[model samples]
Target: MGVKNRIFKYYFPQKAVDLKQKRRGNCNGIVLMYHEVLEDSIDIPAWTIVKRSNFEWQMKYLRNNFDVVTMDEATKRVCGLSEGQRPFAVVTFDDGYKGNFNNVLPVMNKLSLPFVVYVATKAVSDSSIYWYDKIIGLLDKRDDLFISIEGDDIPIRKSHSNSKRWSLMQKALSKLKSMSASERDIEVKKILDENDARSFSSRIGMLSASDLGAMSKHQLVTIGNHTHGHELLDQISGLEIYNTINKANCLIESWTGIKPKHFAYPNGNYSENVLDALSAFGFSTLVTTKPGIWDGSRSLMEIPRLGIGRFETKSQFKARLAGFL
Candidate 1:
């Protein structure tokens, strides 16, 4: 281990112990949200794109100290349906990144850890990559390019290196958020072509049907629907949003022989209509990217999660997981 990692591990145990003492007898569980577990850094710079070594360490720590459970178990505990004195944890990955199948699943299998994977169903069946991935890949290829959205000219700086790309992409994507769907698609296509980069589809490949099938068969994994297309629920009509979620659940059930009972909002943002739609579809629980501990009083449809990323050191990881910081 490096000096920093060694130091983190040395100091983390005391921090965990301190937190445990302060919140004595609090029956709370943590739902950790991870996107992609990668061996090498990708174009995106979010801390949640955790390195393989760090991810392994985090999992090892959890295995050694906590009783990691599935989303189903966490839901049951939150609903007062399970008898348990031991603390619980649930691991989930959003967006169905191919990396989840290629890299994360093997580690999980080796440890016999159970996890939940929420997928964007349309992306799974199609060759398209998620829009966010496409944006980052385009920016990575060209530093001289300037993206103009809504009369705002945002310069793409060469100095914004790989480590800073996620911040830059967030700013750029925010600008496009105001555009009509057709207009945004046109602009994104042009940007990709100008830089000789493949659109999102060619950048981060989605999980194939076979990959989903294999993952479903694993006793350690559960699949959840993340909408047919990752549409912002608040912006679309109620019926449209319902259809998106319903289609995804139907597709997953056909593929896996199990209808998913859990749902995760796209972008971790939702509307009242969205929640009602999930309830109408018979969803027992829903998860969001917001950070906090679950104490069973929060809305089951909007349970929060602390998103883990690349910037988190081992100490920070432990602190967050232990609810110390």
Candidate 2:
């Protein structure tokens, strides 16, 4: 192992994290972000897809080291209304992937841990695949395809390896992320049409309405709204933002028999208008992809979360949670 890995393995970072929290009066909490948890590796080129074993290990470590609290409790801890261990932690998953219900639930239930899973309501209602997954799936299947962006043809070579595919996908996603919702959708559709590709199942599909309903009934699971179409709120108009969130809120309420109180910005993209739109819709809490310790210093409407990626080592996981990375 490298020097940093060795230090993290020994948990030397925890002391620094603890001291930092201590210096801040021990009021900070950590909210972890995740997307999917697969039963095993299928060599997906995404960082958000954690394997079952790694997820379980991370959960167990959280259970033993930090006070794993609910979103409500974590909010309270942030506001100094509740007391717990220093550096409280909340687990959350975005995109409402089927793996969150299939692979994540059992382990979380076994550990008696509380977590939140945010859903893109339209994807669930229509049983559609996410745009990111669609891209990865299509690219992984062929070596001859090339994607045209901004009058440039980007080649997609399989090379019979994941590294090349991963690099290209990252480039594509970065470009897509910069585009408006309509533009991104049009580009994604074009890629799909040209390739004559359909998103094949490798356990990365969206959760169905039934799955969400069942998960909502569980004690450890709290379902949150991602949006109607999972559009980037910052790039859209305020009216569009309100409509999307409102639509998702109504759908989620219909499915779960309870209105979702929490919302997560799609792709962590948000602006002042986005914040205002969510406020108008009456969401009690909001989460973003921005990484930091959740102390009372920040607004509940723009809470920060540390995402746990798939390829992270145990030591890296520990160091990250301990606030050293």
Runs in model 1 lying further than 4 Å from the true structure: 1-13, 16-18, 21-26, 41-48, 139-145, 198-203
Residues forming the 10-long window of minimal summed lDDT in candidate 1: 195-204
Clashing pairs in 1: 47-309, 47-310, 48-308, 48-309, 48-310, 129-200, 129-201
**Candidate 2 per-residue C-alpha lDDT over 92-180 given as tens digits, one digit per residue, 9 for 90 to 100:** 99989998888899999999999999999888888887787887666446456677777767777766455456666678888988987
lDDT of 2 at 218: 97
Q: TM-score of the candidate numbered 2?
A: 0.89
User: For every candidate structure, what is the RMSD over all alpha carbons to the true structure, in angstroms?
Assistant: 4.0, 3.1
Cα lDDT tens digits for candidate 1, 1-325? 3564456644677556556734733256888899888776554455446777778888988776566898777777777888456667788998898888888898998888999999889887885776667766565354565666656766667776644565556677876665666888887776667656643333456788788999999999999989999887777888898789889988898888889888888878787777766678888778998898887788888898988877677776786776655
* 325: Cα error in model 2, Å: 2.1
